[model samples]
Target chain A: MTKALWRRPEGMSVVFILLSGLILVFIFAPLLKTVTSSGPGTLWGTLLEQDVYTSILLTIYAAFIATLVGLFLGVPLAYILARRSFWGKGFLEGLIDIPIVIPHSAAGIALLFVFGQQFLFGRIFHGLGVDFVNTVAGVVIAMMFVSLPFLIDSAKDGFRGVDVRLEKVARTLGASAWQSFLRVSLPLAWRNIFSGSVMMWARGMSEFGAVLILAYHVPFMGHYPVADSILVADRFASFGLDSARPVTVLVILISLITFITLRTIACRGVRT
Target chain B: MIKIRALKVNLGDFWLEDINLDIEEGEYFIILGPTGAGKTVLLEALAGLYPISQGEIWSDGREISHLYPEKRGMGIVYQDQALFPHLSVKDNIAFGLKFMSYPREKVRERVDDMVGLLKISHLVERNPSTLSGGERQKVALARALATDPRVLLLDEPLSALDPETKEGLQGELRELHHRVKVTVIHVTHDFEEAVALGNRVAVLNEGQIVQVGTPDEVLRRPKSEFVAHFALSRNILSGRAGDGEDGYTMVDVGGIEIRAITELRDEVHLSLRPEDILISRQPLHSSARNSLSGVVADIIPRGAVIYVTVSLPLELTCLITRQSLEDLELRRGMKVWVTFKAGAVHVF
Candidate 1:
């Protein structure tokens, strides 16, 4: 009886495996079907198209610029959130996370109110010869506003993991506040910050709703500013599913390859 | 020299209140306390890590109450050995020197000197994560001392080590202090550690300094009941005191009358060190003022010594050697005589 019981599969384990397998299939089936549906010639033709390739490059470039902006502005805020306790700290954290929970298009509308030509900030930037409506800068701002929380939250967790005593020791060793942060805290938290930047970059590249509302045609090659998501949507809307399928497949393939490479680099960076 | 006058710090739930100390140059001073006694807080305050709510800290006649920690000329090492994980051990030792005006070669020389002095030269190339507890602590010490701060603050630097490792590091710390002649402020909850390392020890209870004196003075005559208990005096009894013959005050503990040399009267607490009491088969004529015959309650064998509790209506613990315990064949319920001199009793 004991031998038979040991040989039998546990009910819970079987059930768990079945449930997990179902989710895996649910996630991978559509992606595999979409890639396989397009032939190699069609994918190559889609990549060869000037509009398709330029839009893809524009999307990647805009996301990179947005990530740089996030790093410049978000790291200090992350450090503060991790280290110091003050009034309204919780409220401030909640405010940072509001973009993650709210609808991206709604967020874009909110951004437009602040950065539009008639608004206060928009007027100030306009004085500097920068216009937000239907520009590359608008696309970057939209991407950054939606994807900043990933970088900030990850960096905050990293900084929080460091022992405060290390900084105190550094201060006693003749390091100023900034020196200690640069030498000790920053080096220790670089991995988290790096991975977070990657996450923000990836999120920015895939952003559609916010970019659609903020800048449908972001200037790229020559005088035309066209976005990848907008082009795909336009093709589908004008020429149906069959016409847009190749470009969609090309975009997915490029994004997956870039995202996987970055993720691998991040994992290796953490290991070392 | 360092002097702290009326130093007060408020850390929300914990507060160090009205702390005062005068540490001499090159002196090995210890801050002794129980857990949550605000000992580390006091050390951090001295290091200028915490803002002083009220008080003055003067170093070499300069008031540094509001100075930044980096300007205070003090180096602190924590028990956790907070070595930067990303930096190699050599870089960790050379970390502070880089911030100084020293040239690159000078920084390297200073790092080398510290490594040699701490005998961590072999481990200099290794990561702190790969080091043993003792090695990590040595590296921490080397890192702290490389900057040549005027004062060295060690917060339970040896508490996390095993007994053998702790003993080795304790010797190294003493030798290092002798060689460098920097004023050291060490904090620990272990009374034995304070006695072993400190030239002068200060006892902290709650948030206040209860007593400050030499190790002998603190051990022989603790000023407060809390100190007495913390110092490992096992027999603390509450009683009523009255005038007795020969200038000896008698205390009535439970139903027993114990004689002690004190001017205190009325209700009092008495601290009697276990080692001060003599346990024997029979009472003999001695210079001791108190002798009571009682039944042996328990015989607890600690390392090197045996603790025998005797109940003369009120139980009192006395320390005896293992040989004596065996030769006397002491067991539970055996009648024994416990005696101590009136001078051995500490009344508070």
Candidate 2:
């Protein structure tokens, strides 16, 4: 059976098999090397470090905050874009795609112009004792600015996949607009929205350029730490590949565990 | 009662213009049209799902042209049934009741009532995705009816089912309407379904209503050549009026003489429904004044009905029940008498 499965007549093309094998090896080799380069003891020791643990915690919580804010603002915009046609709709969709094309550094600079201390909205927030400069708000906003398109676009696709007739049926069934959305459209689009949220959260957690520019130093869980992306970069720059390899492997393992768990839940959600 | 006047709607390339309709209370009104005739658009406009460019809609002595759909007290069911996939059958049936603020126990009781009403008690715990197409349709109907809306809008609700399932659901729908007595506006392209369910029907073509009347009237007297071909699927023939005797006019159709009850001009078009003509081995003796001897050219069985083509110099298609065809022992090249009342001929 194994011999017949590998035979040419089993329908695998030689060229496709060769090219796919090459690409898979190219992608997996680096990940495998990184994981094995550092001993399991060294990775465990790094995870036990208070500063390293706090940095990872800060990155996750900041990304989580950013994702929650993204849901409040992005999901409605996605629903509107999916359901209605109005003037400038084409231009608005183009604007949503603009963030993905621009450099992350440029995006950070643009956010700084609107959110820096001297700006009007920034000063108003400053008066309320909520500062963005080197604060958690700064990290969240910077991450949200860079990662929101994933949430909005994915949610829009999810909403578009739902039949408009379903919403109309809800409306005629004595459900108000908000009720219909909460009861019908939201549940049907939930799996895609959830997957998109996970992507946005993961992307925000690994954000480097924006967080480095906006908030590089902060007291996270009583330890002065930056985002994990910045810490990894700084360690790589200062100590070279040999010293930074363990932290990189640790981060990859943590991301993989979370991604797998959440993705499994999302896939299961769509079926049941 | 529901009335629409001068209703005009524009949805990109498709548009409905100068539409007017009056539906009696508790009547099962069918909007019959082929695809892209704007039947769904008109129904949606009436349901307040789509905004109309121009028109006033009045229901029950109140003008509700701009009222929101939820406030209008109407329910709509799509062809695919559009049941909430995430919800169980019981929860789906209870969805609209949540908006109505019914107590939890009352909601459950009402859901049970609807479940029983639709004969879907066994499916309460099942997911909509797990149900069969007919079961999904029943669940959708139950959900729509749970709120007890003043009017129900059905857009080809049975079009997606198999033949046997569709027939079963059609009977169920008729029974449901008879028991509930809610005003319904059903949209469909199937003329047989329209005839079976509609108390009155409006024939729509190319974004306009061609005619509106009782099913008997619309099927018996189609106003235009389009309706003659589309709505009734009648056999039409062009002929000239030659002479008259008593209350009938003799029409010369392709060298064959036929009598008609309507007053005739020099040139006229005639429509005769296939089912109105009866076939017999010998000449039919009765009040039918138009009997012609013709040879059976073909016999085509369509489900329970058969379309028999008889060539009486001018070939005409006549419909007969398969049982009658078998009883008459109809066969190709057999000589038969085709008889129809002169009044059955519609002049256009």
Candidate 3:
């Protein structure tokens, strides 16, 4: 490391190295401190606790479902945004990103207006015996609301990178428009979509303010309640740092394992 | 045979208006033009990839103007060789066949045949990203040809390749065209490629079909100034035609009289190919009726060939081999004799 640093130009390297080191320390120091503060016994105990594991699983599962919903709705919009030109297209694209720019609590309030029990849509869904208030469905809706932009933007970039001529070539070769998209464009854009899904999923997992307003207690699958982030916050407030730190470490560990595995799978067949 | 009558397309800023063409069956037709001349646009229109704003297209005596590209029964190869990056070479070739719902065995047979024909059997299992440019081009061609479409449209397919790979593919294309007998409409900005591969060539300039004729006619007898410029006809001089001895016509071009073996009216336009002019130290007693002594004003080396511009009473450009440039010891300001046969002078 010393030899590599010495090989860099001395004058510019000093400032460059100093600034990069600052950023590196800024990000890593907090994470290192958090990991070291939690004891192994506490981590093991949190893992074995039924509520802790259930809440963590509920967060990931809700986020996964939200990502799946995003894939279904966002990919078509992404493709259209990438390939077509029309009036208000730029405005429409910007609209998709509004969830990201706005505060999550504000997003929850907006969603509550639409999904709240007294409102028209809320009453309609409530009549169907599917209530969003304090339910897993509400949790998914909140996650989807706040984390959808990552999937749509990444997918749009992926679709834009594909040459339109490739589709034309496919059409000329007796492949229909649908076939071309399935066999050529989708496979070509899969890596990006996968990465985008992972990002959306991670963002959804970390969501607190929106999920808190939307669904603090998830009556998940008509069974035991699961509330990961809110439970951690409650524990920190009432039972102090030791009680919450173990759950925080557990969430980080599970997220890292899941994120790394999905990333490895997503990396396959990616264009060089 | 394919006939395009008054076809017009509006693709945002660049548009083609009233474009007409007739590509005969089993003929290697070439669309010659410069970049942004709407050559690819015309080809795409023929393939039904783009909607024509007006007029119609009839292929094999049937109107297919509004058909979808997949139903048009045409294959196209783009300049960048857009092979599917996610698929192996064999899978890329087999892609079109999949939509046809052919049996597994038949698809394998056809894929193997194309792989064998293109000499890419070794690369069948390799992804397109791992292949070289020429390899990818061959795979793209194989994929397009696998469907056995009625007409093959090539959009500057050879422009991206190096000289050696291009030359090799050009020969392979010629051989494939002969053996397969598929109707081809190749679009290119390179005049030499058109001259080499085209039975009939169309010159497109700014979305209009300026001229369409055989390669010899397009090269030697361009009908418009655009064609003259696009064909790189350096010598386009207007002259007064006068009667010459022994049933020959003489044109006085800026006080320099050039002889041609043709009858002409009072005035004429002449085009002389630069490569046809022979440069020598002295005028020889040859059958060439025209000979002029001029001082070499400029010598520019373009790859293997050198363009020697001579300032006669009228300026003339002569293309000569690099070895000849050295053998004759030609340089700027040296006087040299340029000779050409009377038949070589194209009088219009």
How good is the docking of model 1, by CAPRI class?
Answer: high
DockQ of 1: 0.89
Please provide, for model 1 over B7-116, each residue's C-alpha lDDT reduced to its tens digit, 9 standing for 90 to 100.
99896787799898999999999999999999998999999887779999999999988899999999999999999988899999999998899999999999999999
For candidate 1, the lDDT comes to 0.92
Tens-digit lDDT string for candidate 3 (B1-348): 999898899976877988888888999999998888888888988898877799899999999998999998899999989898767888889989988989999999999988888888899999888988789889998998999889989999999999999999999999889988999999999999999899999998888889999999998888866688788889887899999888889888988999986667677888888988999989877999999999999999999999999999688899999999999999889989999988888887
Better of 1 and 3 by lDDT: 1
lDDT of 1 by residue, A84-135 (tens): 9999999999999999999999988998999999999999999999988889
Task: Identify the superior model by lDDT, candidate 2 or candidate 3.
Answer: 2
State residue A1's C-alpha deviation in candidate 2, in Å: 15
lDDT string for model 2 (B1-348, tens) is 999999999967867988999998999999999999999998899889998999899999999998999989888888999988778899889888988988999999999999999999999999988999999999999999999988899999999999999999999999999999999999999998999999999999888899999888888888888888876655888999866787688888998888897766789988999988989999978999899999999988888789999999689999999789889998899999999988888877
Residue B201, model 2: lDDT of 90
List the lowest-lDDT window of 10 residues for candidate 3 chain B. Answer: B261-270
**Which residue pairs clash within candidate 1?**
A218-A225, A219-A225
Q: Pick the candidate with the highest DockQ.
A: 1
**Chain B alone, TM-score of each model?**
0.97, 0.94, 0.93
